[model samples]
Target chain A: MQKHFITLLFTLSLTGLNFANAYEMETTFHGVLDLRATVTDSLTGNYTQGGYGKFALNDGESFTLAQAGGEIALNWDNGLSVHAVANAYKNNGDFKLGLTEGYIKYSGLPNASGYRWQSKLGVFYPKISLENNAYAWASKNTLNSSSLNTWIGEEIRVLGNEITLTRLGRINKDPFDLSLTVSAFVNNDPAGSMLSWHGWTISNRQTLYTEKIQLPYFKARMQGYDLYEQASSSDPFLEVDDRVGGHVRAEIKFHKKGAISAGYYNNNGKPYIVDNGQYAWKTRFTHIDLTWLLPQGIVLTSQLLHGDTLMQSPLKTDVVNNDYTNGYIALSKRIKAHRITSRIERFNVKDNDKTVGDNNTERGKAFTLNYTYRLSKPWFLSTEFTWIDSYRPGRMYTNQPINLTERQLAFAARYFY
Target chain B: MFNKLPIQIKFLFISFFIIFAPSFVANATNTLTVNVVDTNQKPLENMVVYVEPIGHKVTLKNTNTLEIGQANKAFIPYISVMQLGSKVKFNNQDNITHHIYSPVGDNKFSVKIRSGQEVIKNDFNEAGEVSMGCNIHDWMSGYMLIVDTPFFAKSDKNGNTEMVIDKSGQYKVVVWHPQMTDINNRITKTINLNSAMAVTMQLSKPMDEIPSQQNEDDFDFLSDY
Candidate 1:
């Protein structure tokens, strides 16, 4: 069914492109190239190599191609547009390339009453992050994203349709604008597997649609354990229970100076269902986001998220049950051609079930400071420093410290086209 | 000597005075200066100020097409005033695409203009405030006040605009700003403008917050959000 859906989406996109050509639509291509030099001090190996480290790089100095991303858009005069973004990454002799997001959007003109409606179809990220507003879902202020947004990038992609209704404040002659959005999606039943197994992480690496995340070495996956049948790597986008999920969000914008939004998401998967070595985990969360343009050219953004996940066995017994919470506050200021940003984050996961050897309990705090200088219209130079302190009992199984502190410094050169 | 004068001579004198008296009124030139200020008495720039004759007809002048440009993801000339029936042209000066549209009254139009391209729209026939925005960039906002009369001007940085009018009688002077909290974003005062006049229009309430056109993200290479 997923294959058929993908094929149908491509077919529709082709058809739309043909129609766009006939209508003399405007097609644009934009992209960005990011290169980074990094130095890290981490005792454990990185999670990409099946270790419990938090950052993306290993414990050494290296120069790497962080990302080369491209986006193509076809916009018709009739309020319809098709957009697609793809990215490539080369890190530590490992090369990865895949599509990040593709969707068709329809934005209707505001009516006489100042109400407008828009809709999107296909695979895309949920509207939960206030930081990753740049191209290819890159964080605008810092090199690393907050824990809450990192998890969203990793596992919370929507493969369905979303509809939004907005009341434009200017046209309505009101000081406040309001919008409501609702979406229904599929192919995300295994959304919470990595969060429960590997705990929360803070990185700017977004999982591609075809990528599977590697899990850390854990005792629960060993022989004679409850999760012995679990896969070593998690396919987060797989459909295991064939159940539909839904999300609803509402926002109030103060003219255009700032906005506050709240949302609820539920992947109503039926537990105890396993398909192709992927287990269905019932996951639900509620989140709030705020973006305010403060005085003195300062931008303030923050997000708070709390959720729970459950995976059960065939006997209706809990295998992994955990409650998680993540929050962050960031402030950025721009002076002429330079910008500086700082953020503080807190995250926690509480194990609620008696799943021996599968310790999902963890707590962590992180701080990030970034400074960016605009070299030119399309070129930017940035330096960032990050510190993370975390405690996880499961790390002790691999002879690693239960309490860990890691730090990284990176300098990046970015070019946008 | 007056008593001895003929009745016809006296009647002619009175008639001449009556006939020439209205010509003096017609030839009288009125110099009007409008000062716009916020509630705190701070000068408010870019406010649209216009005078309309209440009981007389003013011929609408034919105006050249007004051009609004897009550069650095912002609309040039954030506020404008044009006569009714004038045309508007949107020019995309940046090396990017812009989808400009106004969703109000008869001025409603949506056009997609590529970089170094321009689109001319001939639908300024409506006499009302038209608010425009770029569909691609939500923060890019521009306002145009289309008035039926030709006597309209936007206030300068000092909140002053002067107009010299001949044959001005009862006139309605109005001040408009997109962010003004008044009803319809306008404040009106009816006054007789038969001589040199100065009017000060102050807001009773504070203006609504005007969103900055500068994008906080400052990234032009962004996809749809």
Candidate 2:
């Protein structure tokens, strides 16, 4: 059965590739090779291991391959194209090769009123992250992404379809541009489980497609045993409950410099259905973002997010609800080839599920500063320092204090094409 | 060398050259040399220089079609000067589509050209400066200068241009550049081109800032993302 499953996955990827090649293709190849050396100090003297350690980086000092990936984009004259990215690296001490995203998109020419439409299908990430929208989903500002975006990378991928309608304001000589996007996806029932199990953490590591993740020590402490220590990690792209999740996003650009956007995402998963030690999680979130490009190369950005995750017991009588709120404000300035960035972020999670032994209540505040210098056309050097103060009530299970403070200083050298 | 020679010899040489030089040519020819620079005296390339006869009409020499190639997401030869009523063909050499358009000009047009596609041709019946841009690539821009006179040339990298005229007469020297603040104020001076003479034009204001490597339109979620 496992062999059959592997074959099925392989077949689906090939189908996506073949569909892309059916057009008159013109291909562009690009990639980035990034490495970082990091040092961190954590309140808990005992270092975490595996996936959790990689994300938290609350362990011994080490130099590691942060990200190495390549992407090929095939654009056709008929307005059809395909984009795919692959990474080869070590995730949690296990070497793995994975596909980060792949999708086929069809874009239509603008109409008389300067309106355009596009449709995409396959496995891909959402457009909610205004920061991680660059190549390889890399953040353009700091080395470490925000806590909300970090969890997004670790446990969220949409394997379905999305469509967008955009009004080309510039072509019409208008000051504002408007767009609406809607998406329906599956295989994401396990999205919110990791956030509840691990709470919010800060790092730059992206979870590989096939790597099993280890939960924090608090998960075992509160649950009496390791609830997520199975042979395989929860598949974020698995459709256990056979329910389709959907999201809608709307954005407006003002004066070609400022943009305001809002979106709502929900996965209507049935918690009573569990497959392969993975239970369905009914998760939903509302996110809003604002960005302004001020004069003198200054950019100001802000984002607000609120969400809730719920999972029911096997008998369907008891349910656990975890509510989370996250917000951040960031500013960056570009002077020639040098960019300096600073960001302040805060987050809180409230667990209202008294029926379960485990409680996932936590709150944290973070401040980060980064400097990037463009060494050459293909080389970028960056340094970042981050300080985080976190308080988790669940820490008592591991015999540690509830309040924790962590600091990380890291430097990265990247070569991109 | 002339002063060292005998006075009689110098006079004889001057008289012979003046009488025989015009006889050796089909018509009297005079070269109009122009140098264009910014207010700070920096050599400017891509400046269009033309001579308009003050009291007489001069016919344009260029009546054939011209071509501009698009590659590397830019318009090659960013500046072009064409005669009025001359046709131009835009060719796309890159492996992508380019939507070439102009927002304000006497010859306003918008067309999409695909890779390996046939060239799109248009005629410029009106005389004015046409500003060109690619709708898909905001940084891709070009200029076309349409004139009614045949005596015209573009300033080279060293900001120098030489145009040979069939006859020497009273003419106006005009300069136009993409960054020029005022188009009407470009006619610098009027001179009688009786012999080869050099003219220098100083701009009233500094040119626009050089374009940045990072285009503002880049990183838009619709396309780049």
Pick by TM-score: which candidate is best?
A: 1
Task: Write candidate 2's Cα lDDT for A1-417 as tens digits.
Answer: 224334544665565467656745567677767788878776433222323222455455767677787778777656666777777654235455677777777776555565778888866777788777656777767788888788788787777789989886545545577889999988788778777766777776666655456555544433344343222355666677989999899999765377899999998889767887777889899999999988876888899999999877677743557999999999999777788999999999899876443668889899999998988867789999988888877766666667877788889997777
By lDDT, the best candidate is: 1
Best of the candidates, DockQ = 1
lDDT of 1 by residue, A1-417 (tens): 357446846976886977776787878788878899999887547766567778777888878888788888788888888888888887767889988888888998877777889999888887898887778888777877888888888899878889999887767667677999999998788899888877888777788888888888888888998988888788888778888999999999874478999999998988899876689899999999998989996989999999999999877799999899999999999898999999999999999999778898899999999999999988989999999999999888789889999999999998888
What TM-score is obtained by chain A of candidate 1?
0.97
- What lDDT does each candidate get? 0.85, 0.73
**Which stretches in model 1 have alpha-carbon errors above 4 Å?**
A1-9, A255-257, B1-45, B54-60, B157-175, B178-211
Tell me the tens digit of each residue's lDDT in model 1 across B1-225: 887889999999889989898897886888999999999999889899998989888664848688888988888989888888888888899887788888767778788888999888776677887888887676678888888887888898989999887766899999998888898889999988879999999988899877677764655656566
* lDDT, residue A390, candidate 2: 81
In model 2, which regions exceed 4 Å deviation?
A: A1-23, A43-54, A91-93, A218-232, A254-256, B1-214, B217-223
Enumerate residue pairs that collide in model 1. Answer: none
Which CAPRI level is candidate 2? incorrect
Worst 10 residues of 2 chain A by lDDT: A45-54
